[model samples]
Target: MITYVYLVCKSLSLLFSSSALDTSIITYDQTHLKTPRFPLTDLELASLYENWLVGHGKTYNAAGEKERRFEIFKDNLRFIEEHNSVNRSYKVGLNRFADLTNEEYRSMFLSGTMKRVKLNRMPGRNNSNRYVVRVGETLPKRVDWRERGAVNSVKDQGQCGKSICVFMCLFVSFIFLLVEGINQIVTGNLVSLSEQELVDCDRSWNKGCNGGNVDYGFRFIINNGGIDTEKDYPYRGVDGTCDQNRRNRRVVSIDGYEDVPANDENSLKKAVANQPVSVAIESSGRDFQLYQSGVFTGSCGTSLDHAVVVVGYGSENGIDYWIVRNSWGPNWGEK
Candidate 1:
């Protein structure tokens, strides 16, 4: 579910996802720009895989796992080679996820209660957006909250758990804390809020590590009188016993959250321009998994399975693009 809110300001209804332009917004559809490429020989593939293993410092704990991963690595290597070989708007490269098959990647990151629990259980499809642009509302040609010291540093949700919703929801809250300058985030003093607070404490309509909802997490923070700082509560990745003492050390809070009107790109920009907006997206496609850099003119699906923050939007080389703040650490995304 795509959720929106601000540090006591306006919020847009666009789902977790793009661009600066004339008042009228143009939604971009994914285009497949594949090029046939020669495959690497088995010997060459093995060599590259060995080099990748050394660079990434990877080792399999169990027998047969290394060999099993090797095949998947080769396929991903071919994909990266093919994508980089072509003249596409965006590019693909091997990342920390290079060794996992596309199915494994999606199931681990995109499945479970973190994403859509069931099609019928999806939230806010019929809800109205909170922010709407006037016919002649003026917007900046570009909006980057990072430059304004609103967005926090990139982070990685270790593979110990599947609480992506926890990371994304807290990330948005962190940004709002920054934007509101709550405790000096705007003065070059950044803070990492505790995602584990929501992961462990917020059990209403959410599971701890298996999966969770961003909206429900926010409500937990609000009712709890705000969340604890990461320094106090910290993230353990896995679900653990809730520490009420740490949970009571409230740090920041938001009044409420709203949904960005589904499929409304225009309203999304408005929300992002005012303040970073949390978005839900379908990040299960293979193309998205290997995305390296450049503007992502997506051919990805619309399953709304993953969440991220849209920090800003602008036009690049005449093509408008959104700057998404992903939680896969600094190694991933077009940051």
Candidate 2:
């Protein structure tokens, strides 16, 4: 026997406006009712639970804690199943982050270490030193550095507070590949830069593992000649010695970096069109933690806590969004 679940809540419309949850926008035929799968046996649930625990690297200090975490994991799995049953435009599923509470998820994956960038008004430009725009020029509809093979694969920060370093490394790597004329079709010779090198060595005004700023990282890159490749200085998720011998493995260098005017999306768009721009945004909200695929129309503030890279931007289903490259691994969102 098949069972169907219908979501008819009015609040759901407001909660997921981008999803077009309102019946007015979606006709009766457009609404999809998912058929329920066969219920798992107790033995099956136990096996799945063990696999999930191992897959997510979950652990407990005591028997009581383990029991509590197991219940939480089961609840999360049920939530995923129910959420998937709804007639939403996007899909949601269980991943490494499924079992975590909202706070735990934010602290582990979404926590950022970005420092506010002080912008200086240029004499002849529109506040920014690098980005210049004409009065009535047509901007591209979409610009993805990933499509052009300039951007690297999404990396996982893995509980380390080195988001700032990861953002800096990704932005610099994109710029380096762009300058080198490497494209999607010809990426065999492209090199991935090391974020661990910055984490270990660049300690002028930034703290390793704890937190840091991208502005200081950019300065370090310029002064230290260049950054080493990831193969030469692998990330250990902790701070270590800056290998003097491996300093010769520098693969990418940047003279400097410019920040777009604060809270100015237009200036940021221009910057991203040229290259992947290092950016910081509020990422500690529940909606952000639960974000699946689709344009993120969630309640994101302008606190600027976590650092990320804006690789591209475009409008989807009339909702405009910045294509942010996160450091929370590929399993967390649209990889």
Q: What are the Cα lDDT values of the candidates? A: 0.59, 0.54
Query: Which parts of model 2 have CA positions greater than 4 angstroms off?
Result: 1-51, 54-61, 74-91, 112-132, 159-189
Question: Who wins the TM-score comparison?
Answer: 1
**How many pairs of residues collide in model 1?**
7
Writing each residue's lDDT as its tens digit, candidate 2 over 29-82 gives 112312334376677667666765665567878769877776766676666566
Tell me, by lDDT, which candidate is best. Answer: 1
Stretches off by above 4 angstroms in model 1 are 1-43, 112-130, 159-189
Q: Ten residues in a row with the worst lDDT in model 2?
A: 1-10
TM-scores for every candidate against the unseen true structure: 0.76, 0.71
Count of clashing residue pairs in every prediction: 7, 0
